[model samples]
Target: MVVRSLAAPPTPWSKNLVEPKIESSAFVHPFSNIIGDVTIGANVMVAPGTSIRADEGAPFYIGEGTNIQDGVVINGLEQGRVIGDDGKQYSVWIGKNTSITHMALIHGPAYVGDNCFIGFRSTVFNARIGHGCIVMMHALIQDVEVPAGKFVPSGAVITNQQQADRLPDVEADDREFARYIVGVNDALRAGYLCASDEACITSIRNELTSTSSSDSSNGSSRNISTSSMMTSPYLSQDTIAQVRNLLQQGYKIGTEHVDERKFRTGSWKSCTPITAKRESEVIAELEACMANHAGEYVRMFGIDPKGKRRVMEKIIQRPDGQQIAQPAATKENSFSGSYRSYQPSVATTSATSGQINQDTVAQVRHLIQQGFKIGTEHVDERRFRTGSWQSCTPISASSESQAISELEACMANHAGEYVRMFGIDPKGKRRVMETIIQRPGGNQIAAPSNSHRSSAFSQPQPAPTYNNKSSASSTRLQPEVVEQIRQLIAQGNRVSAEHVDQRRFRTGSWTSCGPVDSTSASAAIAAIESFLSEYEGEYVRLIGIDSNKRRILETIIQRP
Candidate 1:
């Protein structure tokens, strides 16, 4: 029952008596407070203003090679307070090579596993910290159970109990302190403390021993409710199996198995019922077992080993919850094919049927026989069969002779019409006639004659002469000659003639006059001039005709 008062004078001599089992070879600041039942392991360094207190009830234990930076406070409160056993007390357990940074407070009833990092100003309280966890700066932790290897980010506030709906008024410094504590706890649960399994186990065992002592010293009754009791972390394997079997039988895990006498006392409805405590303990034990077999469970269940076990419990609730097996196929052979249905319709008859041309058919047959496929080489076979060879057949030697003769006749008529229309042969008449002959349906013509020799011979005959002056001037030309003149102009040609035969040919309109003369040459010139004056709008300029021939040209250029 050694009790030390907070107000007691500092004793320098006690330092000699309480020599460290493994003292830090490095400098430790004089202002820092290091007190009671603490074991600072070898090669550890303690910075200035760092306070470490392992009190009489709960001692503080640090593993080898750990560093305590400036402004760090490592302490342990009463132990054995959680569990009922009186012999053991709570302890602060830190793993090997862990670093506790500036202004970090590590107070227990809390367990920290190995190789964890407690960042600046982290706070921890009554939490089970896992190995290899990281607690960043300014974090708050309270009454939480953190698993191993998690990273608690900076400024995180983790609280196990639900806070009041309305927050209590608190100073900034107090809030800051609370955050630090939470941060430390978070680091512990996240497994930043210990790097290895051995270190983790050692930290947990030390914490358990220390907590046991605190529980005994306080003389607090172990009043675990049935729910809590069943969930205890120390349940036997046989007990866990029993719970599992009961769960399989549809008995809820947390339900009370109350004796009638106990029920009369209204304990069944109590907030912390005895049945609940037992059930809680059982649950805890089951969880621990599952945690131990977590790797195996994850492999079987396809879940993370360190994940929450509620999901695992649900999965295990049904007996046949394991992966279902697929059935094998029984039939050995199968056949598949595509099928289509069709319907027939009545045909219609043609109104006017024509015979296919034997000549054209023979030509097509020859083409086909010469390795030309019907559908591939030619198009519109039905039309080709009925029409004249000129309509559908390609030009052959036989077709060419007929075509040439037809073309020659067409050219002759065109030439004759053109000369008669313009009163002279037109320029480029031969080319224009050739073009007309070459057009798709324009190839056919009457047989060529000796008159079709050359352009010189194709010129129009001379016009008949007229004598009376006034009568000649008033005479109207034949309409056929006028039409011929129109055709000649349209054929892109020049026309010229000898005499003005008004009785034989007439200038239809006398809108304008030309030079009058009685001689054959003069009358021809006068007639040409008169024609030009009447239809000057037809040819604005004569390209090839000279000024001497202008009078004759003008008459020829007149519009019909």
Candidate 2:
């Protein structure tokens, strides 16, 4: 392991300063960066481009058999100091047998426990991740404690405490769900522990070959558990068919689509008996298969395969779980006549043959009309794929350029009508129309003014004006307006449109206020401290206004 430090000496009085300490058995790739106060335990594999910078606030501690995968960035919390009971600093403390995948960030005060898998591009900031947790791709975990055995889905942002508490219910997978990932890492760690590159490769190859051969030979002789059968992708076609048949009859496929595809079924409680001791045997088999097939999977499915590892980790409920009833169609073709039918492009000429011409604009337009999306680049590559121009003719640069210019011209001529014909929403139509109109020599057609409510893209509304004669010093807020604000604050609500209106005039049941613009409301919220002092008993605190200019106030209730 290559260990270099940036630990500088502190003042004579402050006694706590340490250098980067990595165990002898640990494997730190040459490209990996280790900065101040980072401690790595035995058999830890730090992959290429991984950076562990324990520079600020606290130190970092990576536990044994943990794999810090490629491009992973772990840092000490920049702000808070979370000191332990032992008087030691707490930073990004990752537990044993954890696998932190590529591009994942762990900014500390983060405590990730044992047997956890932090998926690709996932983030952990100022949070506690319990044991056996699986945080999937693109998930942002900030300032929230994730419980043990919970699965965080892709693109899920668990920023609030309440969201964290309800995470387990959202995740279908439990402790055993991704336990295989840690086992795979353990094997990889052992290989990296070898003296040389050749030795490591040989060791891994020998182990996998032996295991695969043994498993294949003893397949019929050994008893397989339900969990193993469910997860194993290499099960016999007959067994797979039988499982699929069973699931089709009366079962809900709650697991990830990929895993479900493998088992032909999903999260079924009745499938496995918890009372039986054989479940452990199944899990053991699963771990073995995972470790053995790790290399093959990395090759077959690159990294972060199409399975719902992050999003669909939680087992889906029963098929009958609160399903909304839809009207059953008597005929197979339930779609309306308005739905456009797809057609293949007619042009069969290849661009390589130099048959490409300026008439390509018409051809391109035809392709688009037939439901093709043409990008400026990769027109040559995406010809055979869905949503691409499926014409027999290859797209040349000149042809593509001309087509793009023509499309732009068409947009410039009548953007609103084009977007309307293309079934774009009101908001999207406005955006497209704005973009077109903003461009030089483009059309400036207004939005459709058919509705009662005028749009920003339609005829613009005249700005509302307050009584200009009323001086700021003499403008006293109405008694009812003060009462409305008080009631809203008491109810833990901001001065929103739901409770109060911005206008001086009353519109039906909405509580009207004296003409108060956003600037005036902001000043009013700030001056609430002085206003509360004038009151006899009620305590008041002015919370800041939100982006929508809704005033937030708080009433401090006195205890009886």
Candidate 3:
């Protein structure tokens, strides 16, 4: 018996013990212990309070580029565990760049593959892990085989046995166990068990086998090997041709060439294996067929399919004749002129109806032909004129031509008016006004009246002159004197329009005034009083009143 040392002699304490022999830089904590027949890899960082012990019969191999973090304990038991190939015990294979984090325990007779992250405080016992797996924190993984690219979330307790066994009265069935094993094998080949735990694998295997056995008893032979059935010679040519093409494209045939363990138990095992002579003949036939039908194949299939079939087709058809073009119609019998109609189509009705008037249509056409925008206001005004009021539609060729004629006539009549209002050429002014009014805050500017001005007057007249300078001055002051008399008459006395007119005449200086009715006199009196109170004038007076002689006549008449 070969006896080996269980532990190495302790070295002087340091913050990290990274051996020169290891390719990776591992930061091993001073408090933790690592001993005996263990190899560490590149870029590995071991955190505080971690222990790695290899005391078993087999050596422990930690793969290239892995991290073992704080408080993790990795140990191998001395007892041998059997796996694959003739009951031999092999060394534990920890794959590249895996991270085993804090407080996780990995017991040996296990294998973990590359790029895996084992989460904190998880227990992995007797497991086979595949590449790119994430075993989350606080998960209890026992007696399981985890496949590639699997994620096990935190706090999950994964047990090897099925759920039925957890019941008190339930007994494990041998048939069920056999079924479970077969189902797991099926799942592995189908790639469905990539993230399977022990219980999941067991369940899948049991279900698959049970279903398969039932199908088998019904006389269905769906699981029979493809090659077991004799091939017809007729199909052999096509089959061989297809196989040859597939192989040329880098597809592998038969289980032996690829990983045999990754394949299903009976899948493609009995197919006639590719041989050098058969391969050559198939390739030669495919090439000949492709050459014969190259033109037709190119026409029928697009570039991609034609290229693919160029190396694939074993049988091909002859090319058809050249494509023919239809004959053109003679000028005398052409349908083009007959199809032309001035009336707009139903689709164009809204676009071409009263929404675009004959005048606007003419104007728009001219502008488009000249490569200019019809003035925005011209466009807007025309929209309103045509009863649509708001819309921006592209001018049609016919409509554009019509609009040009109408715009010319409109410009001839309104050019002077436009210049007077906008102080620019009518067209330029229209464009500027549209631009200004279309701006975000342009609504603040007063909008011009939509009503058109009459063309009767081209220029405004001068101010009118009065007959006499004093009469002109008196006329100006007449409104003020009438206003004063109107105020005097309104002291609780009802005054008529004639009496107000007489009082205005009595003040000869105010002769230019017009007669006022009772309603007018009352309103005028109120207005005058309000003006005097507001202005606080000192020289305000009522003129032309009767003196003491009128009082003597009134006293004599009272005695009689």
* Local accuracy of candidate 2 as per-residue lDDT tens digits, 27-117: 8876677877778889788887887877664577888988899899998656665444345667778889888988999998888888888
lDDT of 1 by residue, 1-560 (tens): 11122322455323333433445443344455666766666656665577776553345667666777779987666553222122344467776667788899887877776666777798987776666666666766668766766555455555643321111232232223333333343344234325335778798889999998886676534545443454544444334544545344333342211222332121222112112224445465334434543322111111112321211111121122221121111110000111001000000000000111112222222322233322111112222222211221222322212222222233333332211101111342211111011112222111111110100101122333334232233223322233223333433333454322222122111222333333243344345546555543432111112223333222222222
Q: Candidate 3, residues 1-560: lDDT per residue as tens digits? A: 11122234543322233332344344444455665656666545555567776644245667655667668988766664525222435445566767677799888776777767676688877777666666656766667676666555445455543311221121122122222222332323233322335777787789999997887786544334223222422223434433444454444322111112211111111213323234444434433433443333211100113223121111122133222111222111111221211111111211122222322332232234344444322223232212222322222223332333233333333322220111112353322111111212111111221111100111111213223222122221232233223332433332221111222211211111222233344354444334333323221222211222111000000000
lDDT of predicted model 2:
0.44
Q: Count clashing pairs, candidate 2.
A: 5
TM-score of candidate 2 on Cα atoms, chains taken together: 0.37
Compute the lDDT of residue 509 as modeled in candidate 3.
15
Off by over 4 Å in 3: 1-21, 81-91, 161-560
lDDT of each: 0.38, 0.44, 0.37
Which segments of candidate 2 are over 4 A away from where they belong? 6-17, 83-87, 169-174, 190-560
- Specify the poorest-scoring 10-residue window by lDDT in model 3: 551-560
User: Model 2: which residue pairs collide?
Assistant: 153-310, 171-314, 172-314, 172-315, 254-316
Q: Please give the distance, in angstroms, between residue 179's alpha carbon in candidate 3 and its true position after superposition.
A: 37
